[model samples]
Target: MNEEEIVQYFKCQLQEDTNVATAVAAIKTLLEFLKRDTGKDYDKCKKMMSERGELFLKRISMSRNKITTLCCPFIKDGAKILTHAYSKVVLKVLEEAAASKNFSVYVTESQPDLSGKIMAEALRNRNVPVTLILDAAVGYIMEKVDLVIVGAEGVVESGGIINKIGTNQMAVCAKAQNKPFYVVAESFKFVRLFPLNQRDVPDKFKYKADTQQQDLLEEHPWIDYTSPSLITMLFTDLGVLTPSAISDELIKLYL
Candidate 1:
């Protein structure tokens, strides 16, 4: 295996594996194997790459199909959509419905990673009108937006959403504004860990550096959780779900 072959194998394995840790371990092994094999097999590598691409497309198609069936009907023409973070599902939904000429999106410039900037650029390329706002502006802008959509990193059985640090504030604002807030995520992100209280939620914040003049450490970490009630809906590869509906839908995964 060469570089291309190793990448293709990783993609293929990712398509089949739902366990994040296991998938990562498998990719590491594949990379190690490729490093040991110096011989480059261009033809074989190309074939594997093609197959991996096809599998990637298939998985995306599956997710798109589910979202189209479950959520498209609820989208109003010319609605203002608000989203934070970068999500393939959210992008695909916008793309699939672009012809409707029905929606414009507002995206936050998610700090630290600034993933939202990448999403904004992609949406612009697709000719989707996007309003890029700072994280703090979300509440102020929420009143102007008709809907709130966010991507989740992990979802608990109790229906709390673990996402970018600012996400909880966004959800809180959306609730205060009485706006509909939705989470667009894949079912794989759901986690079994149930926090007994808000305090039980992990402290994703960490100190990164210390400035001598300021006498303070600069901490930049990721992730926060929003309580279940703050979310209006959850869109997954399976379907649109309410917070209360999550546990039942998740049980199907075990079967």
Candidate 2:
């Protein structure tokens, strides 16, 4: 499946899926492979699709491995790592780290949805020590954290990232405390768009709040942009890179 096909699937299903971005990225690789091996032969096309399917799975595996390999070094035994929201990649890295060294994770209960609680529970299930904190306590806990890791929704050309609404604040807190703030994302999440501010990102579907404060909630957005200047490094499938290098990598991949 290519980007358009995956997109169409979501449209037809009329449901929200968090994996849509990840799916789009995987299918994009398959589409690129088809472009390289263009031909009118049916057998050749079928063979290409078969190979592409395997490659797509391998790509996902590679990305997860790269994330663990690259980020684990930063997670020493007894390290306290803070993360916002829940990212599968981030979870995988934490699990991988736990297999070797002991570390504690601080999860911010990502408000409105409390996805952070889910993350904390998942880590506890994996036998990793976890502590649940309110979203407002990010700055208070920053002094105790060794590193701050997060997943990105979209990594823009400006080297900034679009992620869960509290990400920007987390990044700012990390920067203030001189802690390592890293974004673990696959290269496929890189996009050509350059967002100069938070408003540049299009609005995501508003999750209905069951609370009576819905009127006040309308002013808050689900995602926010973290400026590149605040980020310390990017752990990607390609390698560990500076935020400024994102533009160069994107050009090489697309152009």
Candidate 3:
């Protein structure tokens, strides 16, 4: 595939799965095999792509497990946790913690899609107490929550996170209340993005299809960027890192 086609394919994959890591894995596999495809027969090239795809999936799963394990300690016994949207990684962390710690979770009814119900249902199945609230209630319940933790679609170079639209509101409330706002994400979700604001986020992430076809004023953005200053820490497969750490390191290396 040419660069433009590959980029379009990646966007479609991401929108379908709602998982950046999986999308990246798919592209990585394709890119790695693209050169090999030029010299190999069709069957051989197909087999190579299949094998690489499986490896990337396994690695993604392993990293998620590692991140879950690393963040387990934060789910203290009887804690009142608040989370937004639906994050598989966040769910895994809570599930692992539920094995021992007794805690209740409050999830935002992330608007436009209302994915929080899915998260709540999943937790209920596991016997974890969960309360689903409207997106606007993030601050109303902030005082009752011990901490705010959410998942990310992307962790940008500025150390800010792009996640479900309501996340920034939750983060702001957390900061105002002096509550720790944490992000649970895999290292692969970290990208070399530098968004100055929510609008600065790439359209591919905010919209499900080609941006030029849509009218922004009438569109509901799928996600928004939360500033690094609002976050207390990030629990990633790589390790627990302060937002500044990501900025200092990613910028120094990538820039």
Query: What would you estimate as the lDDT of candidate 3?
Result: 0.86
Tell me which residue pairs clash in candidate 1: 78-102
In the range 20-78, model 3's lDDT, one tens digit per residue, is 65767767776776756765576786799899999999988998898888888877899
lDDT of 2 by residue, 1-255 (tens): 755876577554334444355666666676576667646564687899999999998998899898789989988899999999889999999999999998899999998778999999999999999999999999999999999999998888988998888999999999998998989998888887887887676544323232223453455677889999999999999999998899999999998
Q: Rate the local accuracy (lDDT) of all candidates.
A: 0.78, 0.85, 0.86
Question: Over all chains combined, what TM-score does candidate 3 have?
Answer: 0.82
Candidate 1, after superposition: displacement of residue 1 in Å?
Answer: 14
RMSD to the true structure for each prediction, in A, is 7.7, 6.8, 5.5
Clash pairs detected, candidate 2: none
| Per-model TM-score on C-alpha atoms | 0.71, 0.77, 0.82
Q: How does model 1 score by TM-score?
A: 0.71
Candidate order by lDDT, highest to lowest? 3, 2, 1
